[model samples]
Structure formats: structure tokens, C-alpha cells
Target: MSPLARKRLGRVALNAAGVAVFLFAVFPVYWMVATAFKPNDQIFTTSFIPFPDPPSMDHVSRVFTQGVAGNSIWRYLLNSTIVALSAVVIGAVFALLAATAVARFRFRFRTSFLILLLIVQMVPAEALLIPLFTMVKRLGLYDQLLGLIVINVGLTLPFSVWMLRTFVAAVPKELEEASWIDGAGRFTTFWRVLFPLVAPGLVATSIFSFITTWNEFVFALTLIGDQGKYTMPVALQFFVGQRSTDWGGIMAASTLMTIPVLIFFLLVQRRMVSGLVAGAVKG
Candidate 1:
């Protein structure tokens, strides 16, 4: 084939591959939503049905009214929101400060600290689950939202710090120095000038922390035993029975569980984009 024809063929192949991957990802979400609208009788038999010919709100209504696994879906959603938002807020404060320090100050073990953070993240949560369980139990924190928040913070903090550190270091230190020279305190410079500049870093890190905590299952299951205190991920387990799984209810619950996260991302998505652009421009 001619060189021009070969390039055209390659481009066509690439586009085809991209579409295939998109479909692979999107099909599952489409299937989930489709299944959520399905009636119980139709769910197992017609799992691949393209669209509900006569969609029923029965599953969603039950999810809202009757709940599943012993607690209302909304209650689990509320618990998830409280835990996730709290984790995000706490993690952001630490990440921002830690990122600033790692980016700005050169000190002994600076590289080691960054590496250590990565190492901690590498350790499997399952591996530490037993020890963590015992520790929480001993501290009288087991089954408490406070305990979950602490663990989530520890799990998410290191990665968020490293991510924010990159954004922080990308910023020009001269701007900070100028503020300092003009009689601004370190806190003032960071809060007044630097914080606004790094809003994207904060948004990105906060989203990471929120999603991590919100979707976390194993830890929530291990730590919290009470149905009233269950996060959405753990609470979704209630849809299963020994004889038969409540597939429709599970799908409905999972679908509802995603709403808060979707809303949160939509709200902060603009800031995240702006933060990236600001970082690139300032860098």
C-alpha cells in the first residue's frame, strides 16, 4: 500500500479500537441503569434487554420507601455522604499543607518522605485489616463513623499529598517570595495567595478522597456492624438472600448510591479544570 493509504488505515484502526473500548466501558453502565428499571421477574430472564418496553418505577420506589438489607437506601447514602465529605475535608487540609511543604522547602529526607508515602499506599488494605480491626477495637472506635474516617484519612492522605505536591511545585515560588517580602506572614501567603492558586489541586485531591471513602467496602464491613451505621457499599449487601439475590433491588440501590458522587463531581468539575489550567499557566 502507498504511505498515505497506510496512514489512513492506521487512523481508521485507531478510531475503531477507541470505539470498542468506549463501548466496553459504557455498556456496563448502560446495563446497570437498564437493569435498575427492570421488574424482578424480567431481571434474570431479560438481563440484556436493550430498554424496558414498559419501565416500572417499582424498584426505585421500593429502594426509597422500603429500603433493602434492613436500612433505607437513603440512610446508607446519608452515611456515605457524611463519611466521604468528612474524609475529603480532613484529607484536603493535610494534603494542601503537606504538598506545600514538599514543593517549597528542601530538607533532609524530603525524597524519603515522598517515597514513604508511596510505599504506605502500596501496602494492601486487606493485609492490614486484622491489625486495624484490633487497633480500632482496642481504642473503642470499632463500628463508629469516626473510626472509618480515621482509616480513610490514613489510606488517602499520602496519595493526595503527593498529587497536590506536584501541583504545588509546578507553581512559581517567586510569587510566594514576593508576598513574603511585602510583609505577609507564611500563613497569610499560603492562605490568601497560594490557596486560591492551588484550588484545582484541592478539588482534585478532595474528589479522590471522597470517592475512595464513599466506595470503600472491605474496611466499612470490617469496622461497622450496625445496619444504621453502614456505608452505601456495605449496605448494598442487604439485597442478597440465601435462596435468591434481589438483583433488581441491588441494581436500584447501586444506581441510587452513585447520585451524590455524580452531583459532587459536577459541582467541583469546573474548579478542577480551572485549577489544572491555572497550574499550567503559572508553571
Candidate 2:
């Protein structure tokens, strides 16, 4: 084949692969959304229905009206928002400071500190549940939303520090030095020069932390005992029963649970894009 023809064929093949991957990732989400609007009769039907013939809001209505676990759905949403946001805020602060230290400063045991962060990341969160639970109880934080926030901050911190370190290191140290020469204090140099540049990595890590904490099932379930304090993930579990499951309700609740994450991404997407471009230019 001619070289141009081969190149064209390869481009076409890559486009097709991209489309396939997109569909593979999106189909399950589409199915869940479709099921949320489907009537009970259609949901259990033998044959496939690509779209609900006549969409129903019965499941969504039930979820809002009936609520979950003796509390309004809003309560659970609020709890989740509180915990996830708190964790993200706290985690981001610590991660940024730690990342800056590791990237900028020459200190003793720096290599060992970085290695320890990696080691913590490698440890499965599930394995630490027993010990964490015991510690939280001992500290009188068990069953409180604050405890969950603290746990999430701890859980996400090491990875955030590790990830943000790259962003910090990517920034030209010369910029900070220039700011200092211009009479900018250490705090001013960080806030004005470094923070804006590293914002992308911070947002990325915050999103990961938020999502991780928001959808976290094991810790939220184990740490919190009060129904009033249950987050969305835990609230969703109330839909399951021994004999049968409320699949429609589960789908509906899940759909609701996803909105905050989508909104968060939408709000930060522009900033994230700008941050990436800024980092590239600065680097």
C-alpha cells in the first residue's frame, strides 16, 4: 500500500478504537440511568429495551418521598458533602505543604520520607480498618462525621503528597527566587508564585480524594454507626433486602449520588485546563 494510504488506515483504526473504548465505559452508566427511569414491569422484562418506552419517575419519586433509613435523602447527602469536602480541604493543605517540602528543601531522610509515603499508599485500606477503628474509638471519634473526615484525610494524604510533589518539582525554582529578589516574603512567594502553578495537581488530587471519600463504603460503613450520620454510600445500602433488592431505588439513589461529582468536575475543569497549560509554559 502507498505510505499515505497506510497512514490514513492507521488513523481510521485508532479512531475506531477510541470510539469502542468510549462506548465500553459509558454503556454501564447509560444502563444505570435507563434503569432509574424504567418502570418495575419493564425493569424485570426478559427482552432488552434500549430506552424505556414510556419513562417513569416512579423510582425517583419514591426515593425522595419515602427517603432512606428513617432520614431524608438530603441528610445523607449533606453528611457526605461535609465529610468529602472536609477531607479534600484538609488533605490538600497537608499535601501541598508536604509536597513543597519534599520537592524544594534539602533535608535529612528526605529519600526515606518519600519511600515511606509510597509504602503507605501500597498498603490496602481494608487491612487497616480494624486498627483504625480501634484507634478512632480510643480517641473518642468513632461514629462522628469528624472521625470519618480525619480518616479520609489520612487515607488520601500520602498519595496526594506523592502526586503533588511532581507538580511542585515541575515548577521552575527560578520563579520563586525571582519573587524573593523582588522583595516577596516566603508566604507571598508561595501564595502568588507557587500556588497558582501547582493548582492543577492540587485540584486533581482533591478530586481523587473527594471521590475516594465520597464513594468509600468500608470505612464509612464501619466507622459510623448512627443512621443519621450515614453518608450516601452507606445510605444506598439500605435499599438492599434479604429476599429481594430494590434495584430501581438503588439506581435512582446512585444517579442522585453522582450529580455532585459531576458538578464538581464541571466547575473545576476550566481551572484544571488552565493550570495544565500554565504548568507546561512555566516548566
Candidate 3:
């Protein structure tokens, strides 16, 4: 093979691999949406039906009108949204501060602290569930959205701190020195200089926190006692019975659960791109 021919062949192979990976990731999403609209016969037939013959909204209609577990589906959505957004906001603040300290300062046991965060992350959330439940109860936050928010923040904070530390450290100390020479105080220096550069990392971490909290099922299920307090993941349980499961309803609910995440990613992706360009221009 000539050099140019080999190069072209490699490019073609790379493109084909990219397309295959894309389909692998996206096929499940497409199947879920299709199943949501499929009629019972099409969904349950022995042979495969790739597409719904005539799309039906029976599941969607029933979800909206009948509600779940005697509460509106919208209520559960609102609960999940509240918990996810709150967790993201609270987690970002603490993570930013912690990352700054870790990346910027020298302190006793600093290395140990970083290692401890990793150790905490490696410990399964399920193993900590009972202890966390006890603590939440002691703190009088059980069965509240606040409890879920606090749990999520704790769960995501280690990763956020670790990820953002690199972004923070990538920023040069000379920038802060220059700001100090110009009479900018510590808070002003951070607000005017460091924070803008770190914004991209913050947005990236926020997306992770939001999606994790939104899709979290075990904590949400075990922490809250009230039916009305359930998040969307927990609310989906109502569609299942001992004898039979409501596949259409489950798929419909899952599709609905996926939309907010998609929209959030689209929004965050634009901001991340813009932030990167702005940081580059500033540099």
C-alpha cells in the first residue's frame, strides 16, 4: 500500500468505528421511544417489529391523565428537578472552594485529605445507606428534599473536587500576583480572575451532579417515606405489579425522564465550548 492510500484507508476505518460507536450508544434510546409508541401486539409479538405500525399515545395519555401512585406525574418530576438542581448548586459551591484550597494552599495532611476523598468515593453508596439514613434522621432532614440534596452533594463532591482541582491548578499563580499588584483584594482577585477560568469546569461538574441526582433511585427510594415525596425514578415503580409489568408505561416514563437530561446536556455543551474559547482568548 502506498503512503497516501494507507492514510486514506485509516481515515475511513476511523470514521466507520465512530459511526458504529454512535449507533451502539443511540440504539437503546431509539428503541425505548419506539416501544413507548408501539401497540401491545407489536411490542409483545414473538417476531421482531422494528417500527410501530400505527403509533399510539395510549401510554402517554394514561400517564398524564391518570397520574402515578395517586399523585400527578408532574409532581414527581418537580420533586426530581428540585433535588437535582439543589444538589448541583450546593455541591458546586463547596467543591469550588475545596478545589481552590487543595490546588492553591499548603496545609497539614493535605495529601491525606485528597486520598481520603478518593477512598470515600470507592466505598459503595449502598454500603453507606444505613449509616446515612441514621445521620439524616438525627439531623431532622429525613423524608425531605433537603436530605436528598445533601446526600447527592456528599456523593458527588469528591469527584467534583478532584476534577476541578486540575482546572484550578492549570491557572497560573502569576495571574493572581498581577491582580494583587493592581490593588485587587483576595475576593476580587478570585471573582474577577480565577472564577471565570474555572467556570467551564464548574459547568462540567454541574452536569454530572444533575444527571446523577436526577437518575438516582436507591437513595431516593429508601430516604423518603411518603408517596408524594417520591422522585421520578421511584414513581415508575407504580407501573409494576407482581403479576405483570406495564412495559409501555415504563418506556413512556423512561423517555420522559431522559428529556431533561438531554436538554441540560445541550445547554451545558454550548456553555462549555464558549467558556473554553473565552478562556483561550483571555490566556
Instruction: Per model, state how many residue pairs clash.
Output: 0, 0, 0
Steric clash count of candidate 3? 0
Per-residue alpha-carbon lDDT of candidate 2 for residues 105-154, written as tens digits (9 for 90 to 100) = 99999999989987998899999999999999999998999999999999
Residue by residue across 1-283, what tens digits does model 1's lDDT show?
9999999999999999999999998888777888889876678783457886689888899988999766778898888888888888988998888888898899999999988987997899999999999999999999899999999998989878877887788788889999999999988998888998889767877886787799899999999988899998998888898899888888888888777677878877765565445456657
Q: Who wins the TM-score comparison?
A: 1
Considering TM-score, which of the candidate structures 1 and 2 is the better prediction for this target?
1
Candidate order (lDDT): 2, 3, 1
Deviation in angstroms for 100 in model 1? 1.3
Tens-place lDDT digits, model 3, residues 1-283: 9999999999999999999999999999999999999988788779988887799998877777787788878889999999999999999999999999999999999999999987987899999999999999999988999999999999988877876787898899999999999999999999999999889878887887788899999999899988989999999998897898888888988899999889888777754454335446557
Superior by TM-score: candidate 2 or candidate 3:
2
Error of 3 at 211 (Å): 1.3
Cα TM-score of candidate 3: 0.85
Give the runs in model 1 whose Cα sits over 4 Å from its true position: 1-14, 46-48, 260-283
Model 2 scores worst on lDDT over the 10 consecutive residues at 270-279
Candidate numbers sorted by TM-score from highest down? 1, 2, 3
- Global lDDT of each candidate: 0.85, 0.90, 0.88
